[model samples]
Target chain A: MKTCYNCNRLNKDNDRYCRYCGKAIRNNSYYTGLKIGIVLGTLGIIIMLILYAIMYL
Target chain B: MKCIKCGAELEDVDNFCPECGELTAKGHRFFHDPSNLDILNNGKAVKLKKKFNAIISIFSLSVIIFALLMIFTGQNLMTPFGVIQKKINYYRYGYNTSLIKTNNKYNFKVNNYDEAIEFIKKDFSNQLYTCNQNKELTMLEYELESDYEIPSVVFCDMSLEEAHKIKDVIVRMYALFPNIKGNLTNITITNSKTGSDYVAYFQPAYQFVNVNKDIKENNKVNKTQILLNSYYFLNDNILSQDINEVLNNYYVEDATFESTIAHELGHYISFVAFLREKGVSNITLVTKDNEEEIKSLINEFENGEYLKNILEQALNNYNLKYNENLNLQSFAETISKYAGVKDKNGNLLYSETIAEAIHDYYLHNENAKKSSYEIVMVLKSKLKEVF
Candidate 1:
């Protein structure tokens, strides 16, 4: 079972919304997107440094 | 779930409290967690993080720009580092003010040639003012009646006795060349201790001395004075012996210390004659007209054979090799033979041929070589007519 944060009512675990008040459930996709962005930015900086060294030195 | 406003307990299915009709769902415990509240309200921490990132970005960009500039230009543009290096160089080789203060006790500055002459006269007039007081003193002054005259002086950095000897030689030289008396106002006598050779040269008063001011609006001429090195006169025993031996090979007899002064005076006289013939005051103004005059004069010299023979003989006697293909048809070539040929791009020096000719004419007279004597006679006649 899962608890509805808005209505204070118990619902089925697989339900996407609260049964009593009809509030939509939130997911972890936003946090996952933010982690991917951080990783790609770091890689881009490292690539720029390598290119700079090759061209100049 | 519980509603804090009414302190009422409710079932999970209920939206509001039973006792006070308060909304129990609005006050959820998950949303009221301390950690979540901290993240939502920390504006200062977020602002600080943004400022730190901006600083890092700017610093990295500047470093990259600096590196690129250095790679492209190959010059050290580091301002602070360059300033430090300049300071080090200045400390190492800059002028020594303390030495000047200790040795140069008779230092004086004058505005013009007249003022410099007055200053020198006044200094000499004083009975107490001896050369012993100052071994190295300079009298700085400017030339008179020119549009452009810089502060020039006759420096004497020698012992009292040596300076006096050079002064006497200068007076004698002035007496010989009355025509150059005005230009010979400034005289410098330097000693051997200065690590310089026994060199005597004339520094012209003006780069362009305009003798014919009425003819041209901006006529220029070369007006010069002699500078004598005191070393040859001061240490005559050792230096004169060496010079005399070298001069003896040319069949030149009795070459005294005074002969050197006369030789320099010869250069001055030749320079004056050159200016008069050209009809222009300044050497810098030597144009096709002057070249033509020089060529005609060279032609008039028995078809250049006389000069060619003399030059060839001199070179052979001295063991100095010259250009075999030298064309005496060219005025520059004729002058170069007498003056000693230099590299192609070098300024054609004041003709040493004419100077030596004049020197020989003045000293040897009837005994002087026929070629040199003739050349001097022609130049002197021309100069007398012009002046």
Candidate 2:
């Protein structure tokens, strides 16, 4: 079951809002943006490395 | 609970307050001294509280359930936990030691990597550690890291063009471990400048406690340092053929090179484990740490001649009692002598007998644990005569 948004109460997992006091149930998007930035950086570095190796060889 | 912005006890107001306004932390305005909420809330907020309670309960329950699965499956589930749990993750194995799991086939106790690597180096320096030789490890050190990578043995003695068939055989066995890579390279260096033709090396050492295979009739090919300094089978076409033929004479066609490697590797690895299990130390240099004369005396026992005598006697004195399948007269003068049996009549009996017994014990016995004291003292003393 999902939790209600208003109070820290039990609600069905499918429910969008909290069971006690209505609150958004989506886990805090604390690192989603950070993770995406990291992914982009890693891809860029890898591409650069590939180009550098190709040029040297 | 009063609204801090309005200085008013929480009453009919917006999420802020009528007197003054301040944003409230989520659900903080609803806080009250605990009385009977779940029961009252059920009709009141009962269904909502139950639903939310179920969610929180499931999260905690999931953690418990996953922990149970990790325990039963012997798989490390720490990495899969949440951020806080992942930071503090630990696994336990091998005498209550906490271990960290790695995505490598070379899984072992945390403390063993150092011991494993040190032992491998000692094997390299002394040349005493071979896959098949049944030698007592005087001292050992190990460096145990979860490096599942199979090592590459460089063979400077011959190139793949020269040793194609042997290369195929070695690499095929290596392919068994997912991480093992690289083809054999020959790097045999006689002097600093003159490298031998048949040499290769493997990396990220792993331990092989023992490779038990039949040695009689099959020439036992013991390899040292299967972990690193990759194994190289020198191409002596004539000698290889001779070794093959000798092997054929002793056994059936089923006993092929494939079966032989496992057994030869077993001997070296068992000794490696033996030394580590006993916590042996000071293995950097191969030469004796004590008197050179004393070292010589001890070395003779290692040759395995004397213990052969005592065991041969044990079997001879009691063979008729042990088994009734053998012909009596044929037993007295047989090839048992070459198979580590002593020359005396009783010596062959027990020596061959013990080889069979110990071999069986090693292969089938539920507990293959050793008594180092028995090996170092009782067994060593008995072999003093042979040395």
**Candidate closest to the true structure, highest lDDT:** 1
- lDDT score, candidate 2, position A46: 53
TM-score of 1: 0.36
lDDT for each residue of candidate 1 in B80-108, tens digit (9 for 90 to 100): 23334334643763411111111122323
CA lDDT, every prediction? 0.43, 0.32
For candidate 2, write residues B144-200 as lDDT tens digits.
111222222222223334334434434443342222222111112111112222122
Identify the leading candidate in terms of DockQ: 2
The lDDT of model 2 is 0.32
Q: Which stretches of candidate 1 lie over 4 Å from their true place?
A: A1-57, B1-130, B133-180, B191-196, B206-223, B240-242, B246-253, B274-350
- Candidate 1 C-alpha lDDT tens digits along A10-35: 66666554434444433435334444
Best by TM-score: 1
lDDT by residue for model 2 (A1-57), tens: 644333445655554444334344554342344345445555545544443343223
What docking grade applies to model 2?
A: incorrect
